[model samples]
Target: NIIQNVLSPFKPLPDVVHRITAFAGSGKTHTLRLLASAYPSLKILYLTFNRDDDPLASEKDNKGFPSNVVRQTTCSIARKETQAMGNFEEPRKKVVRDFLERRLGHSLNYKVVDVVLGTANAWMMSSDPELSEEHVRKGEVCELKPEFRALDFVKLAKALYDAMIDPHCHEISMTHSTYLKKFVLSGAEITCKSGGPFDAILLDEAQDVNMVTLQMLLAQPG
Candidate 1:
């Protein structure tokens, strides 16, 4: 039963995106370890969603690593890349709240700003600006408090992106999704200075990764 359910599907991987879905305790980490051990020469970037759940840390403590292996939480990688090119900051909750309050030209609850940022981040990660506007007009996007329109959300996102690029005021602290969105949108080159262009990128617990992170992975040259 174990062979059929788990081991059988763990055949040799091809050079493409391979998604493995299974219930917990299905030996996903074991499979990843096997891949890491097998290909010692290939530069592999292993990513996980939670820093506490990093498999590479456990592996290093237990069995050590090959010379070329790199491991990080997805957010860590995004922040590292963003910092490498220029000065960057993650936006604080208060700053975001104040920005939204001013943009809407009225006071807003802190929770409202949180919701707006969450919705706007998800929208930016998944859809282009034009399509997002279309979806907003079509009533596809979620409605927010004070009857904020789609254009309002779009403008807010653009403002955030602008803040990220501002040279004098590098005060925008960004979430992982926002950072990735800005990284790609700015036409910034992803280089090997941070240990990339890896021959194989292994993502354990990949189900937890968001679309923006996935796009960042796909942006890597195969």
Candidate 2:
């Protein structure tokens, strides 16, 4: 009765956005399941936390959601939305290593490589649209050795962030973060690119969502 009453079909409110919040075991997820069951025809985009494997990535199953309901992690959908598909791990790493070496006037190690890339990832997931060392100072980075913290890694990190999204660097593939970052930078919508906009977006754990993820999910015009 609660589900039926709560989910009663209603006209859209232009200035109102509904947010559901409750403690665990308070029927949050149960409500989502009931909503899907009640509205089998609604084209829903079920956005979830990042997972190692995406059930929707394959053709085997739809993760119990109806045919009209699509499910994907935020990053997976971001990558899909941007049409970035491939394993360019080595190319991207080599680019980072070389970029650092050229900047530091010496060979760079993997630790440095990891920090720079990690920093870039942090910057991408941040709320700010602009690339700046401010992201580095935001306490999002991993624990850095004194040598790193003292060596101006912040500026280098921002530079690397800029290089990843640089339009001229076309041959090398963009990382998922790069795709998501550029998606935010260019005001791209987080639509179901293949099928167009979803009729409704069903975010499972809205409270746990980060700003960048929230921005992407809300970007869908529909």
Candidate 3:
């Protein structure tokens, strides 16, 4: 299958990294699934970010799963998987090993961290220990959360029109942010935060996002 082909070289290349960003309707999820199916034993990790309603809980239902494998709705897990690959201090690795081997936390082995936003300079960097350079530089990559930050069909259409009519305008450059503000001004609403560092991100229905929304989306790492 396509998934098998995508993951064929992964066993020998576990350290290999990849990032996939596609336009709307580009079958990105399908590709992710194929890769997951190919590397069934590789402990594939999925992620979703924090939201206002649910501030910080890594475990969530996966009504959206494509197969027996559960879909992730937070970057928390992927970050953990990435951290698992790092060569942490012996004591910390031992702790992690004990937690994993002893079936601590019911083998759920979960941890949650806060979400941060802004430009590289906009971030404070000291909020979450997991988000520090020490972790990310150690191969701790996160995948984007599965939730959509904004979803106003009309506003999305307007953004598309604006992009086509004026490619160099404020909306094009300020995409999700400006468009989101406009959408709100027109009596619509959405949610978003600024900065993130995700491993592989796949945004569905991207054409439906505006500048403000794009700004929020791109702010996260993938």
Candidate 4:
């Protein structure tokens, strides 16, 4: 027993949370490159908020980035997860039509439906559920016209949620944040069976992350 215990390799310590802060033009990207070069074996998730900045645009441009590193925007991550989970039906138009028809017992023109959907998307992205509901109930969604207030924000929120989780649906059209929020709320395990996909996750433009994104990140094993 003593020999076996002595010979057994020690388990590595759990990773701790890391926060890297720097000013504009600082070497944040450089720092990440250095870390990637130093730890070639480590599986890394490098997330950025900039949709235009493809981290892997050019291997020569990102010379130090290891092959094990996976780079993506938070929205892209959410999109991929949604695609992997199931066939989520595209419900942008259906959600608006159903909510208006079922709740208000009224049919709206295509233009009105479009406006309502745009408003719903904005609310879902904002993360201020309570205030959004209150404003909707108070008929405050449109300041220029009270007729637009016929749409109930609460019902609209529910409609969006229902459309996202509908088993028979085939494609998800909701925003990335909405999909991520739904995925997390559905009790899906964020960490893999072997702990997680990566040894460390690097988030760029962290300030742009919404509550749902932050929660998703926090759910991952450090």
Worst 10 residues of 1 by lDDT: 129-138
* Model 3 Cα shift for residue 207 (angstroms): 13
Candidate 4: which stretches are off by over 4 Å?
Answer: 1-15, 50-54, 58-60, 84-99, 107-123, 126-152, 164-172, 187-195
RMSD in Å for model 1: 5.3
For residues 7-104, what per-residue lDDT tens digits would candidate 1 score against the true structure? Answer: 44544354466677778989776677666666677767667775342546655354454566676676666656556343234467788877777767
Expressed as tens digits, the lDDT of each residue in 170-218 for candidate 3 is 2222212222233323332122222223223334334444343434334
lDDT of candidate 4 over 1-222, digit per residue (tens): 663353233212245556677788797776666655555676777877643336556546665567867777665566556653433334567655665666567765555555555555555555343325542423335543556555565666556556555656544345555676665565454433356557767777687777767767667765
Give per-model CA RMSD. 5.3, 5.1, 23.4, 8.4
Worst 10 residues of 3 by lDDT: 112-121
In the predicted model 4, the residue pairs found to clash are: 88-171, 89-169, 89-170, 89-171, 90-171
**Candidate 2 vs. truth: CA RMSD?**
5.1
Q: What is the lDDT of residue 149 in candidate 3?
A: 24
| Candidate no. 3 TM-score | 0.29
Give the worst 10-residue stretch by lDDT in candidate 2: 9-18
Ordered from best to worst lDDT, the candidate numbers read 2, 1, 4, 3
Name the runs in model 2 displaced over 4 angstroms.
8-16, 25-27, 52-64, 85-98, 104-119, 138-155, 162-176, 192-195
User: Which candidate tops lDDT?
Assistant: 2
21-135 per-residue lDDT for model 2 (tens digits): 7898797766766677676766766777654346345534346666777777777766655666556342367767887888889776677677666666677777677656665
Q: In angstroms, how far off is 51's CA in candidate 1?
A: 4.8
- Which pairs of residues collide in candidate 2? none
Task: Quote the positional error of residue 165 for candidate 4 in Å.
Answer: 4.9
